[model samples]
Target chain A: MAGELDVGYVAQLARMHLTADETELFQKQLGDVLHYAEKLNEVNVEGVEPAAHGLPIFNVFREDKAKDWFTPAQALSNAPRQANNLFIVTKVVE
Target chain B: MTKRELPALSIVEVQDMLRRREVSPVEVLESLEERINTVDDKIGAYLTRDLTAAVTEAKKTDVALPLGGIPIALKDLINVEGQQCTCGSKILGGYRAPYTANAIEKLRAHGAIPFGRMNMDEFAMGSSTENSSAQLTHNPWDLSRVPGGSSGGSAAAVAADIAFGALGTDTGGSIRQPAALSGVVGFKPSYGRVSRFGLVAFASSLDQIGPLTKTVHDSALLMNAIAGHDSRDSTSLDAPVPDYAKNLGRDLKDIRIRLPKEYMIDGVDSAVKTAVTAAVKQLESLGAEIVEVSLPHTEYAVSVYYILATAEASANLARFDGVRYGHRADNITNLFDHYARTREEGFGAEVKRRIILGTYVLSSGYYDAYYLRAQKVRELIRRDFAHAFEKVDALASPTAPTPAFKLGEKTADPLQMYLADIFTIAANLAGICGISLPCGFADSESGKKLPIGLQLLGKALDEARIFQIAHAYEQSTDWHKARPKTIAEGMKRAGKAGEL
Candidate 1:
């Protein structure tokens, strides 16, 4: 069951680097959790609709009018690296 | 009132005194400051305090307002302008909120002073505060045990009388479970009843902010202040908000309460069963009808919760990529490495495990098998509640299977810790409101009396009915008035020790 899923691939997808020990540990833990989750297979949910939310809410549109919003300074206040009121990130094309 | 009695005063008592000018807000703040200075070292309830600001705000408070001059502790997840909102994770180490949450804005408008920031499980992930990267909050009842989590600090603050009432967010029983363990009143309003704007999202679909207080009436008062529609939150319900405090002291006659047999199954502590069973009997004596009902999907609640909550969490937590806010990795060579390394270093073990699990479940091949199936099962769980409500007004169960376990007891096994919320998770899955309050005590092996909680679950948007039932039961019993022995002793010693 553990071999059915690649822990490293999932970690890569999650964008979380894992040590060798953590990878080994999570492989086993995730397998156990997945095994437990397999119990859902027994329940007859053949015709049941998947509920994304408890209450049904739809088309929650607001008027397309501009209003007060966070200033660039406030938005950039917590940025780890910022310059000229712009977020600094690793260059995508280098 | 004496200085020692100040900490024990409920919101109602404190509000009345403020209105009548019997006690100035400064005096109340001073008393609470002294109490927190003395007892908070032992409880670790607060992560940070803006005492100077709180004092300044108290002086300007309007005496006639609903919660005027009342200092309420805020769970760190809720934002307050210019204050640290760590959400119990090191990733947010230096992150200060630039604006206040909608709930905090409501609290401020009602004249409630948001004073101290409380501790919680990191990103609201674990069931114990031990997962908190900053500090460990101890149970006031027994220092050796946990003060439940992820709102552990919020519950501990109210239980130890450091705050009149505190705000806590419930995503998979975070608020109610801790309140149960800490022997305080915790209410999780129905989804959308309170605006989620500015709350640090854990699992967006399941998270709802609520109150933890010393009394059910205080919970209702807090709810009245926080519950309403907000255009800022698209999901916020447009339903008319009721004055929750108005329904209190009402008789519970003709209200049908259901006791689900599935909750009383094996693995529940005998003492917990005994206490909740006795509470049901007390409710029966209070003129409420008690009927045995079954939510057949109860056994699948925890499983379904983990899948849906973590799946949503994985998506919700993706914004913490180290550039916009939170900790950033140094010496990063690339963008992908930056994200991976920052998250790896920022999140704790339990958080990482959930993220990994979430990522896997939502992955392409496994989506239908795990995530989709869980959502469909979630609908079944919701339907079970709907069918039950057709016959009964509310459901009752033990909030947790047992009293507070010794710290570090379940930390090693994530699965075991997940089971601690067995009875409470169903309420979240069904998106109903639930409240946990003191019902009785279970004597530990050392003869120490640890508190047990009786949970009353209500249908979606029907908090008024549950409040009436909970208030009636609470008034009939003296459990809510029972304080932790250790806290009581600490207060006495503080009285002798003089003001800080």
Candidate 2:
């Protein structure tokens, strides 16, 4: 069964605001996609486990140590707006 | 070979010429410049190029190294230090990379020059390069047709003879589908076979960076350069990298190839089916045994992929909110409005659609019904491949259901476009390696020749086995030798056309 999607609510959750036209369009398109995905219900997944990854990757860890990486300037190079080596943004606590 | 024809030659051909001092890397860049200036106007394969720096690097390079001084175009998503890393989205309009990708680092270590930036579907979300916010890439075979995406620019550049070779990522069929449509050799190594340290994530578990080149041997050479472990990418395979070119020219005497019944669905174009069918017979003639196999859950692959890939994409792309690098919204209602409006203004429709659907699936109420269900089905899909692998050495199928479709043919219907990846999506789900190489040509209704690709899938980390089979077939067939006729015309326009 295709879940009923509230495009406006979903868009808000995704941190996006779709136009009226975009909402209607995506709603239909995503409806078809979700409907197609309903085919998953045909198979029995009762005893099956979800795949963790496409490959069987073993444990990968590194010792806690700092290595040479990009400097503050390099990291801030593409910042849309910067000040004192920090990224600028709209006020959140106002 | 004369300098006029230098850019059109394969990596091996150019490597030989450079090592013998017949032509310098500077000469190769010059020839490429001429070709690109002439052809790229119609092809639109490159988003950006840095030939001055390329020539500078080439002049100092040692042609004696394995990939010494050869130029390989990069899909825009792969970051190179100090270069613009636009993943074909307005969100990343002016962002430049702070560090190089591990793949690029390895390629540079092998003496390869990564110069040009190729276009792709915006964030590699679409099947046709039409989704690129930068420019639309056209098929070299027919200017009106599309080069498959999201590596369309990479494929078109190679097909147009403007790029010697290119590196492209395949999450779903970004590399192979485009390679098929453009008539080149594209290989998607096993998941984690190549490190993805600097690759912008789409679906982290599904994405693998690979090569799109003129021949099977060229792809092998590229794999030797880029495949290995990296602690930076925890998922990268810690396995030994093999000489991918070492098994070429070997006979397929004992190799067993399986023809999956599910791949030849009713929706497949008759021409593509005929081409793949003939390719199977050709392999048999080469002394390989052919067997029929069934991937029972193959039908569920695309559905699983869309759900899981989009879910991962939603989470992966969450970092694009207007806080750091990339486009920041000027609209200042509040903190939330900044992120919402910035993404709305920055991302394209298809991207937003995926993000919405992705967020919805992983949303509180729909998690088990969509995301988890898809993963469980994904496990079944993986088991189907595992079961088939127990009996056959490799599986064969059509790389794409059909050759290149016309521009805007399926854009209005996103589902139709998603179905285009039907044949190639399963490999990514199963975590197997696959290669698409030219097998035959299908004449379009207007009588233009379109290349068809035959895909061969091998078990995890079995790139060598698949390469051997593909190389043997490539050597046996003349299909790989045919280049798009527009190449010569483009070269002529550049005043660089001449016989070798």
Candidate 3:
């Protein structure tokens, strides 16, 4: 059942770096979870609309108004790494 | 009042005393603080506490307000300004909430003091609090067993009398399951009933913040303070907020309660079935019509929930890439490596498992087959409840398959843990309200008394009906009044464990 999906590829897609042991462990567990989820295929969903939300809310718009919000200091207060009032991340293209 | 009696008082009782000046706010806070110091070591219900802040808030308490001086615990997932909001995950360790959640603001506006931060499954992921990286929250009834989660700490705290009432988020039975296991009242309001403005998002569509309390009346009281529309949350409903506590004592003479056939499966525990069956009979005796209903698509609830929840979770959790906030992997040479290693080290196993499953299901080739199909089936599941509602005012079922199992029993198998939420998940998927309250108790093989829960579900925005039925059931039975013995009482019997 592990052959149903590639654990390595999915982990990469999720931006998670799994070690060899983790990959092996997750492969089996994910296989079981997905296998159990295969029961969904038994239902006939022809012409059924996909429900993106539980309610029938659509196009919820609010008036564009300027309101007082969190300042830069408050926004950056929880940043793990901050420099010059800006969040610091590793350079993408150097 | 003595500190020993403080934990057992309900919100209504505490409010009455506060109104009479019989117990000051500071006295109430001190009593809970003392109780937590005494029993928290055994129960492990709180993740963090700001007693100093709570004391300050208590000093300013105005007893004239509706919820004046009531101490309520906030599940770590909900932000309280200037307090630690860990979401019970290492990824968010050392992070402080910049502002208060909408519900927290409402609680404060009504004079409810946010006393302590309760533990939960990391980001509300697993059914059991075992997935929490911070600490294991034990069942107050039996410390060896789990308290059901991701709101395990909230349920445990309320059950153990640490908090009069607490708030919990139910993405997929997180609140109700734990509440059921811990012998407390766990309510999940309709999806849009409460605003999600500052509550940490698990699965945006399914996530709802509700109350775990000692009585259904307290749940309604808490709901009155918290339920309403908030402009900050786009999905928040604009409907008129009902006084949930107003119609609580109403009779259920004309109410039609449905028993879903699919929920009464053979795999369910005999004790759970028997207790819930007896509770249903009690409902019938109280002058309600018990009608047989069929939710044929109930079997697909777990399958659909896992697919849809993980898919939504994958996207919702992508913000924890160690860029702006939360844990940052040290010694990172590049951006991609930073993101990869941070999540790897920060998240627990179950979180990673779901993230991977979510990624796989939403991937290009598998999108239509997995994510889209699950969403379509989810529609059918929602329709099943809608049709059932046309015939009955509410539905009744067992909250969990069994009483609390041993801590390590289901951890090895994720599917088994998922099955524990089999009865509670459908309500969340359908965006309806549900409650888990103590119906009866079942004895374990060792003769330890474990509490069983009976879940009552209502259609969307029909929480008042559920509350009426639950309140009626709770009033007729003494199950809600049954409390677990303190850790000291249990230790006196065994003489080996419970050394804090």
Native contacts recovered, each model: 0.77, 0.80, 0.87
For residues B406-434, could you state the per-residue lDDT of candidate 1 as single tens digits? 99999878888999999999888888999
> Which 10 residues in a row give candidate 2 chain B its minimum summed lDDT?
B491-500
Docking class of 2: high
Model 2, residue B498: C-alpha shift (Å) = 12
**Candidate 2 displacement at residue B252 in angstroms:** 0.2
Tens-place lDDT per residue, model 3, A8-60, is: 88898899999999899989888988888888888999999999877777668
lDDT of 3 by residue, B1-500 (tens): 45456666889888887899888999999988988898899999998898898999999989889899998998999988899999989999999999999999999999999988989888999877998888898999898999999899999999887889999999989999999999999999999999999999989999999999999999999999999999899889999988888778889889999778888899989999999999999999998999878999999999999999998899999999998889999999987799999999999998998999988889988999999999999899999999999999989999999899999999999999999999989888899999999999998887778999999999999988899999999999888877776453432111112212
Candidate 2 residue-wise lDDT, B404-436, digit = tens: 999999999888999999988989988999999
All candidates: TM-score = 0.97, 0.98, 0.97
Q: What is the DockQ for all candidates, taken in turn?
A: 0.82, 0.83, 0.86
Once fitted onto the true fold, the runs of candidate 2 whose alpha carbons sit more than 4 angstroms away are A1-3, B490-500
- Rank the candidate models, highest DockQ first: 3, 2, 1
Q: Model 3 captures what fraction of native contacts?
A: 0.87
**Cα misplacement distance, residue A15 of candidate 2 (Å):** 0.3
Task: Report the C-alpha displacement of residue A27, candidate 1, in angstroms.
Answer: 1.6
Local error of candidate 1 at A93, Å? 0.8
